[model samples]
Target: MNIYRYEENPIITPADIQPYHKGFQVIGAFNAGVAEYNGETLLLLRVAEQPISDDPNKVLAPVYNTGTGKIDLVELDRKDERYDFSDPRVVRDVTQNATFAYLTSISYVRIARSKDGHRFTIDNEPFIYPSNEQEIFGVEDPRVTQIGEDYYIYFSVVSPKGIGESMVSTRDFSNVTHHGMIFSPDNKDVLIFPEKIGGKYYALHRPTMKSIGTPEIWIAESDNLLYWGNHKHLLGLRQGMWDSGRIGGGAVPIKTDKGWLELYHGATMEHRYCMGAVLLDLEHPEKVIARSAAPVLEPEADYEKKGFFGDVVFSCGVVVDGDIVRMYYGVADTSMACAELSLQEILDSLVYE
Candidate 1:
């Protein structure tokens, strides 16, 4: 497939916001989903923030608590047998034989306006912030889809209990009505189809599973938007492949005559991420007609090759105009970027052969 990256790469990087609390500092604010609403571009960013450790030379950290609305500090003696902080997945306890849970980190949506989808001007403040008790940590990875007269925003709500998918609706962009959480515990990366199918709402979700099932894309149906059920697995990682690690929906599904085309991100066993495609049957979305045998986009740019996490090209949203699909993705976990490919070309690249 032919991929064209915007000259202005790394569209949005983490900018230091005014501190939420006295002692905490939020950084590494990057990776956003894209949408077009009211002749403006919308970004749903997964802004990562961490607090300053009490000891400047030490690694001991404090986790934030939403229930009591306080920050809980946890001292981890690396040399002690009770703490094991070696694993990249999470910090573990070798002596205690348990995981060392940290305080919750959070994210919020910051609106950026772009006339040409390349150069953007970010707003001074966040569009949405964590207010409710359930959103103790923060909201993350927002996907915006315009349906009918309302703009529907799907995001991941993180808390101490588990990470869940939530939805919010907006008509004027200034005010939003929180519809609460849609999926159950241990689910995220939700992308709603741009239009309704068979008179019901369809969404793509990654149900986080520890064993038996890896992180794969799944589809669910809802009659009233709040409750989701009738889930069917959509795509999974192939053994010894580029996407052998995991896969999840990237942009909201693009509707075309061929099928419902979805651009998704996949990773390898080593956690290197790339982009791919999946085509579902128009009427029966549960039926996957075709998928990408090879990656449509990889970490080719230097910006994508190095950052907070290297060798990654993760897309949260895209814009489709006629035959071209312009995608805004996070490069190397640090900054935002843009790329373009034809809709026909992406569909043709799918492995239906």
Candidate 2:
């Protein structure tokens, strides 16, 4: 595929975002949801922030307490033998056999606006944060779909209950209505189609199964957009291939003459993430028309191969303007970047067999 990355790649970083609260430091600003609103390009960025501590030996995790209605910082001693801090993102308690863990940083969505697609000015305050028990840990990886005048936001809500999909809608970006948790635990990467299909709204979701099942993409339909049903498996992990580990939905599926063009992310068992495309039947979205035998985009750049997490390029949204498709993606779980591909070029690259 002929992919052209922006010269000013890594467009948004932690430095662009201010901490949501005092005494906290912004760690990452990535995985943003893209949209064109009010004659400007908008990015709903996932900003990760962590509590800053003077003591180097102590690791602090910011947690939102529902009862207290405030964020509490939990201090974990680095020398503590009861926990494992092998991963920079999470701290696992050894006593529970690593069954329990907490994120080093709490993530929330913030807005960044740009007159041109490349340069952006981020808002000092967060656009969305953890407000209820369902999102006590944090809210993450948002995908926005504009339906009529209303834009629906689908994101992952993390808590003790497990990660699930939640819905919120906005029109003017000033006022938003939370529709609560729409998908149950252990599900995420949910993206809704911009319009109704067969007189019902449709969505693509990924539900992770711990035992016998691998992480795969699934499709569902709903009449009211809140209550979804008629679930069907859409795609599965290709063993020994680039996406052998897992696969999930990315960007809102782009509608075209050929089919619904979906730009998604896949990973190997080695944890290397790449972006690829798949074409689904327009009328019956559950049917896969074509899939990319090779990744359309990969983690080849130094910025993508080294960061908070390495060897990853995951996209949350894409904007189609005529023949050009601008994809906004997160690099190595740390910062935001943009790349462009011809819409027809991607369709031609798909393997039918």
Clash numbers, per candidate: 3, 0
Highest TM-score against the true fold, candidate = 2
| Model 2 steric clash pairs | none
Question: Which segments of model 2 are wrong by more than 4 Å?
Answer: none
TM-score of every model? 0.90, 0.98
**Predicted candidate 1 versus true structure: per-residue lDDT over 121-161, tens digit per residue:** 77666676665655666777788888888888878776657
Whole-model Cα lDDT of every candidate shown, in order:
0.77, 0.92
lDDT of 2 by residue, 1-353 (tens): 78899999989988877787889888889999988999999999999988889999999987899888778988899999999989898888899878546889999999999999999999877788899998988999999999999999989998867899998999988799999999999999999999988898999999989767899999999999999999999999998989999999999999999999999999999999999999998898989999999999999999899999999999999889999999999999999999999999999999995
Best by lDDT: 2
Return the lDDT, model 1, position 201: 88
